[model samples]
Target: MGRGAGAEGSWPKTARAALSGAGGRGDGGGWDVTVGGFWCTARPSGAPPLPERGWQLRVSAAPAAGEAVLSAVVRVLAADPCGFRFAAGQECLSVLDSGTDEPGSTGAFITVHPADDAQFQRLAAELDRATAGLPGPVLPADRPYRAGSRVHYRYGAFAPPAEPGDDGEHRPVPRRPGGERGEDARGRSYRTPGRGRLPFGASGAEAVTAAGATAGATAGPGTAAGSGAAAAAARRRRGGALPAGRYAVTAVVRQCAQGGVFLGREASGGAEVVVKQARAHPAAGRAGADARDALRHEAALLARLAGQGVAPRAVELIEQEDSVFLVQERIAGQPLDGWVAARLRRDDGPGVDWAEAGPVAHGLLDLVERVHAQRLVLRGLSPGNVMVRPDGTLRLVGLGLAVETGRPAGPAGTPGYRAPEHGPGRLAPARSRVADPAVDLYALGGLLFLLATGHDPLLPEDLPRARPVPERLGRWLALAARTGGTARRLAPVVLGLRAEQPRQRWGTARVRAALREDSPGRTDATRPGGNPGTASRSDAAGPSAVPPRPRLGGPRRRPAPAPPAVRRSPSDTTGVSGA
Candidate 1:
């Protein structure tokens, strides 16, 4: 029979009643059963309005009786719906099975494409009533199977083919996917087996599991299909955004070279969330795999760091067809740069005053120390990676790039904030270039310099003058330009932390001790109250200060090799709390 025009008035009364089982496919006395009366639509949550003359229903009968029922449904449902007057590939249906196959009995699965919500409700009511009369158990209508879960299908006895008519020809039946007629060696007509086999069991009946073929499959309900960047792109072309799964994009947060960052709202709950997407390079090969691997690594690290409270909580890692999405809890604060700008915008001009920024600097260090205590390294510690909370306290975010200490490091922090060891022409051999706690300390020192001088330490103009400040006992001339007691008090410790050689730099324990005045490591001499004109003979060559005898390439006192497992926390005296 030709497919209908989809208008209710044009639908034959007999066809409508047949759908309700007045003379259902079961009544036709065939093993292949046709279950109808399901109603769904192509509209995803928050999707734009479908095109005019949007959707239509099409029917696909099994090529022959006793075919795999699950395969038939998939091929039918996945078939081009546009041929029946629907908006081509734009339409999709959410199928729910109401069949009860107990022992020797079998039933059917219902596929629906309702025009609207009211229509869906009505169709669901009628389905429940119709299935109730059958001896099989009644499956609830609204309880559609979840995506990525399994389902079982059972085929009935096969019916014999219809006899040839007076024309001596049997009715034509469509071939299974990839099955075709070919000539045998004898030139006799023969059928070649298709590429795929029926994933069935030994018995006439077999369980057919639906691998992420449900309504929510778009958000990756199945086992990950190998970095689904291509699938994500297809969905974006169909709809303007990624497929609806758990979170729905609400607003664009920011756009970058990698991809776009968006603010999304959870579908189950209206809570606000942040969604960051990264699109793979269009070039298909090793490059695509590398991009996917990078994205996956970032998601995994952020997920692990989420518990440590220093980074944003990782809500979900969604791998779309052509992109990867990382959904995180919305952090209610601005970037460190924004906070600094706002502070300086107030009557205070140019540089960040030490009084206002010193505590913030301490808070950031304390947090980083906490992260290091967990045996993790904060590889990205630039101003862009830090945030100032509503309470004026500091919290670090973007742990996506952080890796375990001692692991071979990937790329380092943005330009000026990274340590010299992480910069070009490092003294350490490439094989021994593992990340260390010293890098974190070095970045913290650069941050201190920026907060004090309102300038990056590595800026080309300042590099010439800043190179000598690290070795000098006097206040850094750049920091001295701001001229505050707080600045002077902070200068010595900053220099100690920013030392070119990791071995000469102060450990977290030493820095904390200096801040608390509990250390005899020149803290007293470095304080503004102590003599500053000429450094104390002991101060200039102390272990925490400049080494008594400077060495080329590395420190005079080489640090012991790190442990094979977790490296010792930088703060050996007092342990910092974990995330």
Candidate 2:
């Protein structure tokens, strides 16, 4: 094994030594080259040393599965920190390129920069252990991309050379049909999955689309959409379910509800957009049409709620070929659960006490109130649906299950946060079909408790043990739970809002008034000379009479910490249940 015959240049002394396997250690500050299969060159010191701030991880996937692979990897990385943790941020990782657009290219490239090198190392080592015994084919040396690139070792190019066969001859190189080279029997470019890059003249997008089609054809019965029967039915109805032209589907994000969510790039502007299509259940007849109609109703509701900041703005609506596509601008923020977890991890101070929960609680309450005022009920409010923007403001999303007030609908909300009256048990023969504002209020209280205590109020058994806070707010909270004095105020309001029966729950006005009262440095609104309570009662009123409340504590001079990044689950992209 030696360097390629074409390696005739002023190679760096260290690199040359490494290629020859001359006394180079793993930790040595020089390049290391592995021969055979596909060449792997490591030049740890060839480029300027990156700062210790973040560790870079390069990922390369075969063109056929590139987009899916990259998406799966991002989901894995963005998941909550369990065995190995990776930070969630816009800078954490990037998709360098999907070989689909390039000629002869058959791979996707991505670079992951973990905020902590040690964590990256642990993750890499764990992955290495997990895939220990998987057998794989050798990669070809002529692949377009080389090991020297950031996507090093992502392909099978890093595999060790094969030993001589028993016949004392190396295995013969596989050939394409017609005895031609660099292509398969199907006339498609030939390359092992995750092998460096595409051939000299392959269309990456075509390969990926073909792969997606193949996958759709073979998708199992339980997935959100796409199967032999569905595709055949779709073909019978039209060439494809979606309308032709306008938006180009880039990748299938995931199946949501009974539908599929696709990532799309607008043809005119090349801007990224999300296309949420109606569910394509295999069941024929009115049931399927009903499902499609439900999605349309959702889209119409979303269009009406656009610009309210409670949901992502609907960009356009396309209804053709018996399919409905709701295109919306992608929301740029972290999930509420992820954000809260990140905040809890970063905060050195005590958990969100009464004062700290004031602003956040009020923000959510006001947002929900706004939606109710618009005559809509967010039937699916949950930590998963809320997104925390970088500016620390919260945006409510996942409006797929939203309905007009008083509308009778199936159970559609996250279970833990659902009001007792809306659960399956209460949906029996005897019940009102009307949706209640108090339902949203119940969810709001649950969210506030989560932010304050980092635990779901309903699931009290698993609550984190109480830690001391700077103020005696914990004691005040406990006292408020029993009897209300001056200090014991927030608990009563929160409890009242979350009461099991909707009739006993506090209204939006009372919740806001309580929040204003609990906020530190503000005189009690019920006291003399305090700002009139009427101002805080209605969000539509001019400027809020209550001063801006500080999070975590009373006002401080320093800018508040930026909200933590949200870790998104695979289903998050589509709000699968609603899509």
Candidate 3:
């Protein structure tokens, strides 16, 4: 059989190897499993209409009797299906966290039943035509085995070849990952001689997946393989707007440099949820590189922190052949900037008054304080990060770039919206250095300034005038805009830490009190308060917490559930009543 992929870095070479000699290769009682037919078409959620029977197969040669054990596991080398569906008797495994370089991998089996003669034949024909003469994925640790009996072939990156009887499907090991898995000279699956081995009669079968293979990444009774982005788009052209409902997709949410956001949604009601993923790992190959990845990070965090205001709630995580996608819950609301200045703006006369923006600015400031108190440093602390719901409620979003003092920080915050530690034009690398909290207070001030003045504090034109501001607002805004030497002096107090150096400028709570009395309506909601119905902060997810389990259970539960783990009550937080 020809190889499919290789390790020493090569592209079409591997793919071609697997598809070399499109049809007619293995004869079970047989020659090696030649590259018979390789049909790999991706449909990433919403662009075209898949032919009613566009999918086809044309592989020849029959396997021997006992060759029943010898099964071919169809894997998704790469896909971008927006709304994919797989047949029954398949396993869909969700691969979360598609890391910087190594995106997520997932897949199931080619449960092509014998009765499906037409579809199978079509699939075979298509595979032969497309993959003909293409090289196979190089199997570094090559092995030769006899027919009739199942032969486990190890290849470049491919492991756990196929299921023993029904033939199992397994994930291929990536070049590198946030973590590592056991491997041999070549990329093949091998169990530690005696570790976790299933008992003799009950052998623990091992199965992994190729990236982006299943619906919702779930493995169960009725599993399906999602198509790639291209195919899904074709389907959309054929069908109209989808009816309304959640859809399992293979597309990703994308943010552009121009700040334009585009997501692929199934035309009908909830047909498919599409998000544009960063093409090349480690970074995106498109515009809005920063915002794009930030959106991804934010989506993943929100997925992990579902229900919490950590980030917008995502519907599904779709790992396509080339990018990482997140299907997020579509929220209906305005950006916070719009709500803050809900009052009419009379741009006609310049000096008249922008006072209507008062409560808006104040509300924004109050929210900023709440954000900091949450013990998170939103690296992307700019106006664009905030959202204003149609109901006149303000929500701080885009936590994708936030720095949670508690968790192992990933690339969470954005540059401008980031804390003072981050530079203005460039974002800080995840490994650059450990970040501190004071920088957040500094950025909070900047964020507040933006709420007050539509421009950024860092911009020279947006700087406060040399003249003194009111004792109340001036003191607060001053601390927010303090830079260099001035920032060093007040930062420590603002951070509530005892340090006094530029790096260690902390702000203790006592010092905050000494600055000035609370600004008017500071405690009240950010919106108008006359209605008496202060919009309650959403019961969004909160900082991760570990509470003592209700002891009705004997010993503590094995293996903690995971963060955003608590049951959220009516309030935004879990267990504790919101003050």
Q: What lDDT would candidate 2 get against the real structure?
A: 0.45
The alpha-carbon deviation from the true structure for residue 248 of candidate 1, after best TM-score superposition, in angstroms, is 2.6
Report the backbone clash tally of model 2: 7
| lDDT-better candidate, 2 vs 3 | 2
Model 1, stretches more than 4 Å misplaced? Answer: 1-240, 254-258, 281-289, 345-350, 425-432, 461-482, 518-579
Estimate, for each residue in 1-579, the C-alpha lDDT of model 1 and write its tens digit.
111234122112322232233222222321122222222122122323332221111221111111222233222222211111111110111111111112111112223343443433443344333332121111111112222111211111111234466899884332222544221111011111232222222121111112112222322221111126644543343343442467766654443223446666787888877776654431112122333456577678776666666776778777776457777777666666556655553255334776688688778778877788878888778776776677767666666567788897644776777876677555655633676777788788777766654556653333445545365422232224333434444565677677776666666665666666533224643544554332421122112333222332456366423211211122211000111
Writing each residue's lDDT as its tens digit, candidate 3 over 1-579 gives 111322112212333343243333321111121121221222222334432221111111111110111112222212101212221110011110111111111111121211133433343333334333321211111111111111112212222222234345454433323344433332121122233222112232221112111211211101112246533443343231111223433322222111112334454465333333332212221221332365566665565555544345566655433234445544445554343344223342211122433344345545645655665555455555555555445556545556565454433343333443344445655532554454454555444444433333332222455422112223333332222222222222222221112233223332343233333222111113322121222111111111112232345445322111111112111100100
Q: What is the lDDT of residue 494 in candidate 1?
A: 70
**Candidates sorted by lDDT, best first:** 2, 1, 3
lDDT of 2 by residue, 412-511 (tens): 5676578766776664333435665667777776676566545455432223664322112233234223322222334445454555556556678766
Per-prediction tally of clashes? 13, 7, 118
The clash number for model 3 is 118
Estimate TM-scores for all models.
0.47, 0.47, 0.36
Error of 2 at 172 (Å): 36
